[model samples]
Target: MGYKLSRRQFGQLVLAGTVVSGFSYLTNKALAQTPNLNIVGIGSTSIPTDPTAIPEVKTTESYSTHQSSVTTDIPPVGLELVLRSFTTGSTQVIADNGTPLLEPNEILSGFTSLRDGTLVVAITPLITSRRKATPNRLTFLGASSAKTLIVSGLNENQQLGSLLGTNDGRLIGLVGSKNGVPPITLVDINLKTGAISPLSQITIPKDKRVSNLAECPDGKFYTSLLGFHGETSLVQLGSNQEKPIVLAQLKVDGQEWNNGLQNLVCSGTGQLLAFGAMRYQTPNAVYSIDKKSGNMTRLENFDVTQIALVPG
Candidate 1:
């Protein structure tokens, strides 16, 4: 039971100060810097799939609500949907054509993009209200969908980590706990149906967590790690050997990237694109990490809060 924001309502939200924090300003700055880059927004006006779908609006009190919202810039048509998450717990699905749309819920966790151009979003419900606790639900959204699908099975205890779309067309999720107990890791989800198949947990090094996941052209996948000291590393996943192999190390401002890694996406080639800022007010950069050598090349810099690859 959400309402689509008209252009006037959008302005009111911005001027009246009801708009989420950090989102409107950052998104506008990002678009201004990348005038040629395409962006789009995606979200639902109604929760058609969740039977327990209740209309709950919790913005000021929600820790996960994304402070950022995208600009209304128009992009070329026929591009894939790119999803962006904000620290405020909001998630947005923008079209390659550069139109931004909003979802009612703040996706405190991360999201993933599929090869087919669909998006998988893990909705973070409001913490204070049981009527709005939307933890375990996943949303499948695309351009040509007859309707959006929202499926629930995720638990609050399952701290949802990286969401990756595998080459085999299966979507994989890394489930871990902050306290580090119940070592059950890795869940393979049925995209069509919100079914979960639990897999054996692999040992991730202590003091480090997965920052980003990206797949290569050869069908292998890569992951970026964030250490306790705010450093980042590239690693290869899924081989005959169970352990992950460290590939490259990345740094920002001549130091270990301490600002934090927000999202990682494949650049449509074999390389991986890492997006994050070292610290607040620091210019954000998109780094291209060579899959073979683990070398990171700075591609561009702007105020971009989130980024993704749209199908050409």
Candidate 2:
């Protein structure tokens, strides 16, 4: 339930519900279309952004605003899917033991899973609009209603957005800067013991803030693409001794760049999926990225409101 992002970075997109301008710019791409990966033509994705309407795939399009984000996945319980909304809403969880836990005025932002399959939800407690000074809260929910996460003291600062769990179940939150200047700083948290630590301490590169976070199957640090000016680049967390590596660069390809990666989450297994669209454009279609090949391909028949990864 802990997060890396301080309140400063979390200001950009509040959950998947309220999306802002385009983020992530590719390094370069005069020629489009990458090779050596699989490319299957799925249908098309359409958002309500344009006056003209069409299918979701096949035609390169644009998108803005998403209703939810896919953060983490626990095999049998479904991907840790989150629904977004400008207003506060509540959801109920029925633990395996059939204990009822009521979550109120909460924003379901991100998720992370432990090595043993326990799930940690990166959530910010819902405060009434009247309560503007409320600090963000992180809670841990066990896979079997073990117990929710508990943190001692929280300063009014520090808002968290996306989250990714380590192979050993350590939680990392994409933090926002609370003070002046550009927001969005990366930070990590230990869910098991509620420890707050700086991810940058582990050698993560800083710059051009992260819009989303997802773990690759290889047990790499983690990856999330950034977009701006019609271009995109996939940034990954590297070893403590190295810098954050840009796996798939932000480059323009034949006038097309993969812009705006909305929600990204990886199954403890090898599957990585993200939903987004062309830069500066309401919701786009879902995309399945090949973590191994740096391939951003389309995935059809996804429920934007609820996306869960089912092992094949």
Candidate 3:
């Protein structure tokens, strides 16, 4: 159920992952000119936003059948509710500028910032963003409170994007076993001192695949390389490291174009925002990376299912 590319078949899988890393792009303004990485456009949720105050809306899906119903079963394209701060009247900002830290039934898979504003939601399950939604492993919550002792450990098929941490709060993600076959990993967790780290082990030897992930700002953890020979890498892990250093790579996809990349934000200084998922209505790309000339740029064309840095 993965191989749905149509932005002209992802521009021919980004021109065959760029002619196997010849490093090119004379289009997206030569990749956003690099640096601050801007390519804005917040919410569309397929269009028909506000939906008049956002109440359940008769159990969901009823903005007049979502504009005109193209239906890819869409329903995780928006929502980052938690106001009283980054005000803009009635904002949405689903990954363009920043907006994420939701914890009511948990959807955000990564984001950190402590103190006055308090937010550390790696709590999973919005249909499957990896982990915490199995035999009900005490799904992190507040009202009917569940993260009581904070023990939900079963990062099944972890594609845990937003690439864990180290900007004062680390919790990197991605770890698989059962369904995501052959070993696909890259983990780290310290959801505020719950400590448990282990980075990089990816063992996909026979038609590869991996998603977007980021953890930069000195302590690197960037990822790319999606299915059947895909590659667009950058991974770094230290502190008595157990191995994880690919420096940079944007070459690896030559076997009938399998398409890759999917949400891996890390902006605000280090600059990196990977989010490319094609197929169906096809429209999601937000590269904008440059960890020091590895170069990549392309933001705002939205379809983004995740990536939040919320702060006007």
Candidate 4:
């Protein structure tokens, strides 16, 4: 059977420096001066246990911060979710009245925020134990409450990908194979029922995979396609366009970025931001992308897997 960590026990693990060490808080000088930009990210720490079994929670401990009294209730078997906020030169966990807005035994698959500042997250089971089955869920975390709804329409083999909230009040998501293959279809997610409706099928080269998705203020959808050998391309997607257009190959300075870029978020002011994953001994960093040129400017150095712009 699976085990759940109490709020206090979770705090002890974090206080022991086991949970937060995987994430780095290094901020670039350019981002330190930007007081107006605020970003929220979802990060994970993997605790290696028996891959075929879930571990039992042993101890209980508590953690406190000046901002809020922190308590965590996630299981300690596979991936522990961390919800973080990034500002000028610091990163901190987001809490609500002594409780964190997180779920247990789940991995963050996709993230997005609505125009009214409502945050939506897509999660799937960690699947640490072979004997137990865990259902996929969608959580709507708002100012006063958090509601998790069971995802019904996805097949057992299908997996949820990046999520985007459009200007017209629709929630869009990418649904694709669990192994991250091609034929990633665009789907509309019902915020009320967690039902998925097919929008359009996205076609990409077999050599590449879609890593992240974003929608600009102008209503155009964009996605990052990562190649097998560290090559990355930014492509534009639309129903009106005959085919996807390659905007630019992502590069920093004059060279292609070998470290892959994941989580893509378009800020309210029209700035495209992404978290660059660690690769080939290079550290993780946050960058702002030039939509037209596909050039990236380093904003900060932080190891975050997924990022969403904090709605103002």
- For TM-score, the strongest prediction is 4
What is candidate 1's lDDT per residue for 155-270, written digit by digit as tens? 65455546777666777776654232334356777777766676544334334466556676687667777555656687777554467778767764455556446567664445
Per-candidate TM equals 0.60, 0.53, 0.27, 0.71
Cα lDDT of model 4 by residue, 87-149, tens digit: 223333322123333335455678777776566777765433333436777777565556878
* 2 versus 3: better TM-score goes to: 2
Best by lDDT: 4
Q: Residue 130 deviation, candidate 3, in Å? A: 23
lDDT of predicted model 1: 0.48
Evaluate candidate 3 by giving its C-alpha RMSD to the native, one decimal.
19.8
Kindly list the per-residue Cα lDDT of model 2 for residues 1-312, writing each as its tens digit. 312222233231122222111111111131122211111111111233444533223213123322222232111111121222111223221112222122323334555445543444454543334334333545443322445554323444445656666655566767653321234566766555555666664444454545566665676655554544435566666675677777675322234445655466564344555665655443455555654456666543232321222111
Task: Give the deviation of candidate 4 from the true structure as CA RMSD.
Answer: 10.9
RMSD of each: 11.8, 13.8, 19.8, 10.9
What would the per-residue lDDT of candidate 3 be over residues 177-205, giving only the tens digit for each residue?
A: 32334345555655544444555443222
Q: Give the 10-residue window scoring lowest on summed lDDT in candidate 1.
A: 15-24
Per-candidate local distance difference test: 0.48, 0.42, 0.38, 0.60
- Candidate 4 residues lying further than 4 Å off, grouped into runs, are 1-35, 46-105, 126-129, 201-208, 281-283
Q: In model 3, how large is the Cα lDDT of residue 26?
A: 18
